[model samples]
Target chain A: MAKVPVQFTLNGSEKAEFIESGTTLLHALRDKIGDTSPKGGCHQGTCGACSVIIDGELRLSCLTLAETCSGADIKTTAGLAEGGVLHPLQRAFLDAFATQCGFCTPGMIMAAKVLLDRTPNPSREDVVEALSGNICRCTGYEPIVQAVLTAARANSQNAA
Target chain B: MELRRDYFADVRKDGLHEIGQPRPRLDSPGHVTGKTAYFADRNFPGMLHLKMVRSPHHHARIRSIDTSEAEKHPGVVRVLTAKDVPHNVYTILILIQIGPEDETVLADGKVRWKGEAVVAVLAETERAAQEAAAKVKVDYEVLPAVFDMEEALKPGAPLVNEYHGQNYYLYDSGECRKVRFGDVEAGFAKADHILEQSYQSSPIEHAPTETTGCVVAPEGNDRFTCYTNTQAMFFTLDNTSIILQMPGNKLHFVGGTVGGGFGGKVDVIVEPIAILGAKLTGRPVSFIYSREEEMQISSPRAAEKVVIKDGVMKDGRIVARKVTGYTDAGAYSRHSPYGAQKGAGHYPGPYTVPNVWIDTYCVYTNRTPSSAMRGFGVTIGDFALEVQMDKLARLIGMDPLEFRFINAYRDGDMKAHRQPTEGAALIECMQEASRAANWPVAEKYMAMSSYRKGA
Candidate 1:
């Protein structure tokens, strides 16, 4: 099979690469582009560990082919922080001690980022509903839920 | 998550710093940023991907295996069988003198359970390895398999494990792990009423977010560096070294941050094979279980069947308790033997029953070999014991909490294992739980303490 060429804006930077026809965006990012943020949890979109924000929508990278993601803008958990400054969600997750084992943190943060970007002042139930796709087996969902609420409050206070 | 005002008033007489303080995990930033170096995160130059050719039949004799088609695949490097393993026979518990080396790194002659690896194919890519693995054919003579614990133990049942020479692994005394304290029959003769009930639980998976995996890099002078997510690092190093027949120092294990082991990753499953693949190919090799494989093949919590018989007095005192149970260890003993022993040790619960007897059988079945999970042996036993306690309380028309308060173990009590109980806090814990739940206790029960009685 011939490698197909792909170009996309990744983490606010333009990048170009050649990928196989059936290569997933996750493989293209980790294997080809050398970005290891998005992890492969269940390669079957059931586990949201491969979540990436593409064109202002949260999509599972494992389900999205690299060819389909061509010319799209992608954002991963690695790109959330700017100039060494932590994103409010990242800061709040740390402050609330929401992460354990940390394998689910990247995808969880990515999913939470999309939620906060769209609904800044999401209620506890809203956070729970938004993060239903992401699974963190260690924390039992309480600390992560609390962290998202804390981040939402912090973001609202900053805006005020 | 607010702490109750009197939550630790009785337990926190001694000041503590790290015990109840809010401390952020050291790895949270790395986790959030996706910069943490898990075993799968690292990629090496000229690294080969390994995929196992597993058995489709639960119980079968391998008539023959044909690896020609797999070897002829374009990117396939090498295919290894049990013959390639230097020391093929192993059980994780062998380090503690608890096994007869029942399992092989790869299936040897026969596969006792479904999904047992028979061949390992190394290739340039994971897809190529998986494709090649599917091509390796095996002719199997399927045999009748027994899956139930009790059925496997009956006379003329299909043998599940040949290493043990029986369906059950015997303790040093040549029987099931036994816990005999006092004359239970005599205690029962003096009782007013008796209750008997059976409890059963299916096997449970740990289902950690990150599945079991390992990456082995061969280095100079026969040294191999392993990056894994195992909870027990030294156990992996020691067991993998034993399996590889190499010096313990030759394998340098670099791991501590498990994605969520919960006792699952303690089994030395992938490291030895990954190391062997690296050694045979003279290149780095990575072997990771897919989520399906992890769920299907990885060792799960042993399913348990417990029968609890209690002799109780009208005053809510348990005169005698006998717990006879079976822990389905599946086809091999990984940790189930020890887990069964632990279950027997936790018998009669945390109470002061005058007489107690426990017999826990580590029974084998033609299922995925069960091993450790969170609280492996004791958790299931506690499930049955506590439920029995609740039922016993209800039968005698006593409040469950008050019944427990009356029978809770105190310090200086003797356990069923002939060991004196020390620092027992069941009374205090029940009191705290009742207080938290606002379950009103009588003034007499409230004064109950775990401190040494009659001191």
Candidate 2:
């Protein structure tokens, strides 16, 4: 098995690694690049625990082949925070007690980040739709939904 | 979520400072930062991936297990079968000295259910391990499998577990957990109306986002450091030590950070074998369940069938209550026996009845073994009891809540099991619930309280 070159801008920094050809972007990021924000809840694309923003598009890292993601800008939950402060969505999730078990938090934050970036002040239904791909078994989804709406409300108020 | 108006908060103690406060969780910082260390997050150098070769047949006697091909597979570290385990047979309840050793780490003689692990293949990579596991051949003689609990209990039916010597796990007193309070027959004879009903529930999977898994690393002092996602860490350590025939001091189990247990991660499923693999290879071993495995192979809450027979008066008073329940324990008795016994204690419901009889049987069937989930013993029982309450209320032309208020268990009231119930609040709780829902209750029902009973 020969390692192939994978070049990507990861979390505002350029990272180059020679990874296995058939390796998933989840494994490449977590196992190779030492960024463990993207969890491998399921190897299948069904569970969005491995969700990452690649080339400005939300993609399931487990379904996306690592070698095919060459020369792409990838963003994960680890990159959500600024220099020292927490992201508004992260703070919202933390405050809302949305991270029970914390397994689904990374993907959920990533997915919500995309939603907030695109749709500021999303409705409760929109927040629910955005996080429909991510599964949080512990929290019955109410807290997570409330967390997203809280962040959205805060963001809209700040803009106003 | 809107905070409900609590009627009892006014009389509550002064020490209750955090009742309705929205507080941050202690793990919030780590969780939001994506740094909470789960079992799978640990990346050990030279860690061997372990995958299982499962049985496709529901009931099959293993004729032979040929692991030669798997062992010879490229990058395959080792292939292990039943013979490799030091003390193969065990039960999770063995720590409490509850049931006999009824299960094996790997199928020793026969696999009682589909997806039973028969062979373990360890390799350099997960893909290689899975491929090598597929290479291992297990020649099995398919046997007749009985899937239903009642069907399995019939005469000449195929036995799911021969160790039990019966389709049902035998309690010390009889074949079932029995609770007899008074003469239900006499009460039924005097009752004005008789109501009988049946209730059954399907097995429920926990389906936690992160599946059951463990990473066992061999330390320098001949000790194994196991990082698991088990909700019960000591259960894992003790069970693993006992299974491996090693002293408990040699194992350092690090856990308690679970990815949504919901009473599902209490089983000591993966740690023992992962520890064995680490011991044999002197390298870290990771045994994780895939989504399919977590759904199918892992034990879920028991599928239960209950028949409730109640003798009721014209005034909605339940004179006699007889409950016959069956716990579909599946292939083996994991916690089903204990769960059945626990279910027995909840017989006749919370209402005080003079005559009550209960018999709950933990029956075995050729399916995945059932264990604990959220509210394992009483949840299903409560469903049947409450539904029966509603039915009895309908028959008597009475409000369900008022009917319950009349028969509600109170302080100094003797329960079905003979224990006097203290601090009973069913009456007040119902009163408050009725008020909160804006359901108009009669003056007498609204005035009822648990403390001032018969006043």
Candidate 3:
């Protein structure tokens, strides 16, 4: 197997690197780039555990090959906090207890963030519709929905 | 969401939330942040990948195995057959009758079902390991397989387990668990009407976002480190120890942040295979099942056919209940006996009855084995009994909710299985739900157009 040189922006920093052809983007992020934000839950795309923002779009890192991310700007859940303060969504998630087992949280939160960013103030039904794809076995999807609605409400109130 | 002064006072006085309050889960952060390290993501130095060679025939006598090509492959480090297995049998799920002494770690001399592991191959690369596994060949003397329970029980049908001398997996004497209270016949005689119905549930997958996978690394002398997505970590460690002929202290089992179990991942699916592969290579070996493999091979909800009978009076009081459950045990009676037993015990559906009888048959099937899932065999049974009650209520020209309210088990109602239900909250839940949804009105909405959509 030949080591292929691939260059990509990770989180915020620019990077130029080479990886094996078979190296999944998840492996590249965790091993090469040292970003552990994209967890490998299901190697397949079934579990959104290995989700990353590629070119401002949420994508499963496990399914994406390293070669595909050569020119793409990547964002991870670890990049959510700008400085010392928690992102409002992350804070609301913590306050609302929207997480359990925590494995699926990153993907779910990223997915939620995408939805919230697209529509700052979403309804309860909209929240459910947003996070439906990300499966949370614990809490039966109730708390997560509540947390999203809470985040949306907070965002709207802050705007006001 | 608020309640009485006493209830609301706890929030101010003790600074505590409601006990049943809808709080979000606690583990979502680690999961959402990608900080959670599920077992398959772990990396180690000199790590090798493992793959298995499985049987194609459901029932077969292993004639011979050819692994020369696979062993000679460029990246392949080791190829193992049953001859290499130190332990003959290892149980994955230990319940009544079938304990840690029953299941096979590797197919030894005979393969009982299709997809049973026959050989394991280890290579430096996962792709290489998979490629090399295809090189290994096994010859088998095919035997007629039995896919039906009734056929297996017959005198001359092909025996899946001839060594056991009977088709019965767990209980040779029949009843997994039996409970007797009042005379059911006498209790039924006092009732105004008797209702009997059979309900069947299809097999369902847990479909846990994560598929079964395990990474096993040799720690020291006969000791191994295992990281897998298993619900019952202790059970996996114990069973793996027994199968490897190693001490319990020699094995360490770590559960990854499982995506979702719903009880399916409780059974050890990828552990033994990974362990066997690691043993062959003497290197860190990781084995991950494909989604298709996970779906077909891993434990599923037991497909059940339950027959429930209830004797109710004119006033909607249930006097007697009898339930019979037939659960498809699949390839092995892993947790079927216990699951079926629990199903039988819970079937009367939280109702008050003087007499009850539940019979559960853990019948055999050639498909993947059935094990635990959410509700632990209670949910399906509950659905069956509740639907029956609704149908019976409609037949008697009474409102379903009213009928349920009339016969609802309360603080002092004796359960069908003879236990007194103390602190029964069904009525309270019903009242709250009805107040929220408006019961009679909700029923009216069910009759509304299917095209209508709203929250």
Name the top DockQ candidate: 1
User: Which one wins by TM-score: 2 or 3?
Assistant: 2
The C-alpha stretches of model 3 lying farther than 4 A from their native spots are A14-16, A41-47, A112-160, B3-26, B93-100, B146-157, B172-176, B187-191, B220-222, B409-420, B440-455
Displacement of residue B159 (Cα, Å) in model 1 is 1.0
TM-score, every prediction: 0.97, 0.97, 0.85
DockQ class, candidate 2? high
lDDT of 3 by residue, A67-103 (tens): 9778889888888877756678788778877776676
- Candidates in order have lDDT scores of 0.89, 0.89, 0.74
Q: Which lDDT tens digits does candidate 2 get at residues B320-356?
A: 9999999999998888898998899988878989999
Worst 10 residues of 2 chain B by lDDT: B1-10
Which residue pairs of candidate 2 clash? none
lDDT of 1 by residue, A1-160 (tens): 6989999999999999988899999999987888888988789988788899999999999999999988899999989899999999999889988888888888889889999999999988899998999988785589899999999999999999
Q: How far is candidate 2 from the true structure (C-alpha RMSD, Å)?
A: 1.6
TM value for model 3: 0.85
Clashes of each: 0, 0, 18
Place model 1 in a CAPRI quality band. Answer: high
